[model samples]
Target: MDLFNPYNLQVITFIVLNGILAISIYITLATGQLSLGHAGFMSIGAYVASILTKQADVPLIFALLLGGLIAGVIALLIGAPTLKLHGLYLAIATLGFGEVVRVIFLNMEITNGALGITGLKSIGSTLYDWLKVTGLTGDSFGLSVLQMKAVLTLLFLLLLFGLVLFLTLRLHRSRIGRAFEAIKADETAAKAMGLPVAYYKMLAFIIGAVLAGFCGGLFAHITTTITPDDFNYHKVVEILSFAVIGGSEIVWGPLFGAFILTTLPEVLRVLAEYKMIMYGAIMVLVMAFRPHGLIGTDTFAKLFDRRRKQAARQAEEGM
Candidate 1:
């Protein structure tokens, strides 16, 4: 079978996009916050980006960044009052916030009410146009335009994911990450130590919002259309499941989980009516047996350390 076929490529693209969304939620969870409002931020980004690109004729990159920044600003506003709530209360507040956002969009005249937005260009098409303008058509790359577009789209998304992953890794090792961990472990003690608990929580919330917004921008461009229903509470649950099933103890877990869960449905398509039933059963079993996910904090670390020790033993034998 052709792996690069359009259907497979679309699925792979969504996997990567969902991986980004998983990371977005992971950022908030890392800070001991249970935010279910990322879907709201995502909707803000999608609508803003769609409007800018479709109406203002803005460039794709600028539209995405602006959309993300706007979402961050909104997060700052919403978080200040709401982050004070803890545990289930915070989750409920955020979930309510998401529903509110959907309702607002659904009624907005600029968003065409419930009709949503469409006719926006795809990311690949935008890239292809730029390439042609630069005198670098598909013929220049010795491939058809469609193939060239696909390759560029994949490469661009991979680069974007790598950038986010790199930043997350840096944050994981930074003082801020430590502060987040401390807060997660004991908020009262963190505040006692004068770690600026509110500031860090707000910062984490804004960062997650920005990331979700960025993901939303990409989602809009990739799908070339978006609606209020797209960012509902169900989407919030799906995004959260990625981190939960993948093991949120480390950064890699959510991405791994996103890949598995996103691709599993396609793999199980042969099951027809039983596809969703099997999928739900698998998730249930994974949660029951491997509560920490398939990869916890020490999973990869232990594997690597064991391999290193085995290599050392072989070297000693050779000597």
Candidate 2:
């Protein structure tokens, strides 16, 4: 069992890409907002970086950041005016924005449109080499290009989850999180209490977009080729679905969702036409049973709490 097998390698890559997109939407979902335009940021990041690296001869690292920045800027521009809206209306508006982005890219001569971008350089082990040089060698073994990507994806997931948890927990424990919860619970009362509803909502949108941009950059590197088809409206829905299927409150839920969902399609591929049907059935089942999602606040608390309670009961019984 050589660890460097290509199939294993591809699976690792898929996990990284899936993890990034899943977590990207997870942030937005945490804010209780559902966006269907996340692919807009993704498109912006992919096209920009691909063009920069392959066309303008920019360095890979710089191209990635530039692409992310471009996407972030676009997201900011769009989010500022739109986050104030609600529900399906917001989803519709975002869906339109995503399509518009896709259409524009499709029509743009530079993008090569529906043909998709190909022949880009693959993201290699250079990043991993740098990590080893910095003394990550003890517990962190050096990796092949694919393994490095998987490790990076895992690391990025951990980092993003930690940062998001820190912020949300701080807010949850503070006046601001209360305001957000208040808004989620009852927007009118929250507004009456002078909560900055629009401001915070917009803040959430922008931050979520930035993360999406970062993920898109990594995505561009991972695929080493891209197309408008890759970041379509369906893709946006997929991102949202992962966050939805996993309860948004679970710190690791979206990643788990990504891992499962990403792997599921492959498992079902043998079913051919029935694969999509099975996928839909699975999702419907999840939604029907896990309404608050797989890890809502009460649910997540109870999970760890259950173990502690069991221990206490055992201790009393022993006494």
Candidate 3:
């Protein structure tokens, strides 16, 4: 019915943000790298975008893109040297980086020292005003102002998902993607085959960072306020959990995980404190049983192939 109500819209917006964060980690996971500090890159993007928009009156789109680019560049700088480490070592290094970022923000005068920057404009407010200017509000639609804003935000997030999905699929089919898979399968063998393993891994890490940064920019615009605490270690772990639980083998897996987990808190509101325990139990069960994730790459590929074959057979019968 009124799914675009403020409460529902808030939930939808969080889910969208979580989905983007999940995809960011998924990119690193695909390259067989476990980066646990995505929230740091996110903070970078959020602060940069917020500062630009609030102080300089930069357009939201430009601020977001610049934030993403800066995050990607930072990832390159961090990844080139650190990507050499594999497994737990890399995770630790990234985690440390995230902590360092949080600490820096905590003490920095530019970030207003822990209190964080506030009073930034919200996308919903901006959009609502713009629509009113264009005479698209009120009796034109049987919906509240919040509903219209929620619908617009949802549409925008969906558009973003499309772009991300397209680029991810394209990357998976390209030579670089294959290179990543090759290294993931066997680093030594991939190296033996003359592939630049380090470069490909760094590329994946940078891409993931850029995506997280972009999400952060959107987050700041939507929330209209951000604090250093928002991107702490716990947040990083949550993002990683979303990726692992969602099935980082494919791009859709993390998004699916983000949707389910982000909505679970609201769905289990009646349980209150117990909801967290229930969430943990579910995660434990999933890890114990579906170690590969709820939707592994093989399962999805086969399902799509089966559908394609079925469609082809039907077309031939028609002919």
Candidate 4:
């Protein structure tokens, strides 16, 4: 059915990008913190990476790392003062901070203000150029230059997502992750246990900020340009919705959610004028019927626990 068409390719690329964004929000939510401002951190990363690549000629990898680091630092600064606020208060503060960041960018000369930045380098084009320089063109790769570019870009982005997923899973099993769960379940009890609830919350926020920044850097390079508008409150809401709608209890949930939501619009294109209406209705249904998301943590936990018990019983019976 021509699944490899250019339009589908672009949608796949965006799915990877949005998956990263969803994971960012998931991290904070996992720690019981609602950060409605990750898009600001993302914008910071995008601009920093964009500037580094366009001006200083830095490598994309290094630019992305530095961008993430900068965003983490900013998160630390912002989180220190704001993380103490709980629930709705924290959400409002983060949302306000995002607005502030947008306003600042809109007035900054370095960012070209509201005019936005363009003419940035595309990772796919960059790889194609590199192949030409290295004399490893279609003859060696068994694919056309354009085809190679798409394959390489997809693989590169998937690798990035794999790393993120691995790290998130590892974090879920770590001491810090246990503390995050403890805090999320009962912040008061965690504090009574001398767990430093505030510190853990701040740490989660910073980690989420770093990941969002990294994703932002990649987004800039992939699209080859970006405007402040791209990382606005609407984008923040959309990214957060991914984690919420997907189920933040498990790392895979957000990735799955990102894939479904990202491709839904394209798949519904046949609906024409009714597509947006349908999309909103679907989200509303999900929220109303599946508040904990499509994937329920309790259900997954019970299923896995049952399997574990069954496996142990089988082993004992074999003996």
Q: Which candidate is the best by TM-score?
A: 1
Give a tens-digit lDDT track for model 2, residues 104-157: 989989999899898776555435555667877424554555666556544554
lDDT of 2 at 268: 91
- Where's the lowest-lDDT run of ten residues in candidate 3? 1-10
Best-to-worst order by TM-score is 1, 4, 3, 2
Query: Best lDDT goes to which candidate?
Result: 1
RMSD of each: 2.0, 4.0, 3.4, 3.0
lDDT of 3 by residue, 1-319 (tens): 4575778878988898788788788888888999987999999999999999998998888999999999999999998789989999999999999999889988998888889989988877766777899989945788777688877777777788778878888999999889989988999999999998888998999999999999989998888899999999889878987877888778788888898889888998999889989988988998999897777778778999999999999999999
Residue by residue across 1-319, what tens digits does model 1's lDDT show? 7765667777888898898888898889988899999999999999999999999999999999999999999999999899999989999999999999999999999998788999889899999998888889888767777777777777778889989999999999999999999998899999999999999999999999999999999999998999999999889988888888998878789889999989999999999999999999999999999998888889978999999999999999999
lDDT of 4 by residue, 249-284 (tens): 777778778988999999999999999999999999
Question: In candidate 4, how many Å is residue 309 off?
Answer: 12
Tell me the RMSD of model 2 versus the true structure. 4.0
TM-score of each: 0.94, 0.81, 0.91, 0.92
**Residue pairs in collision within model 2:** none
Off by over 4 Å in 4: 1-4, 302-319
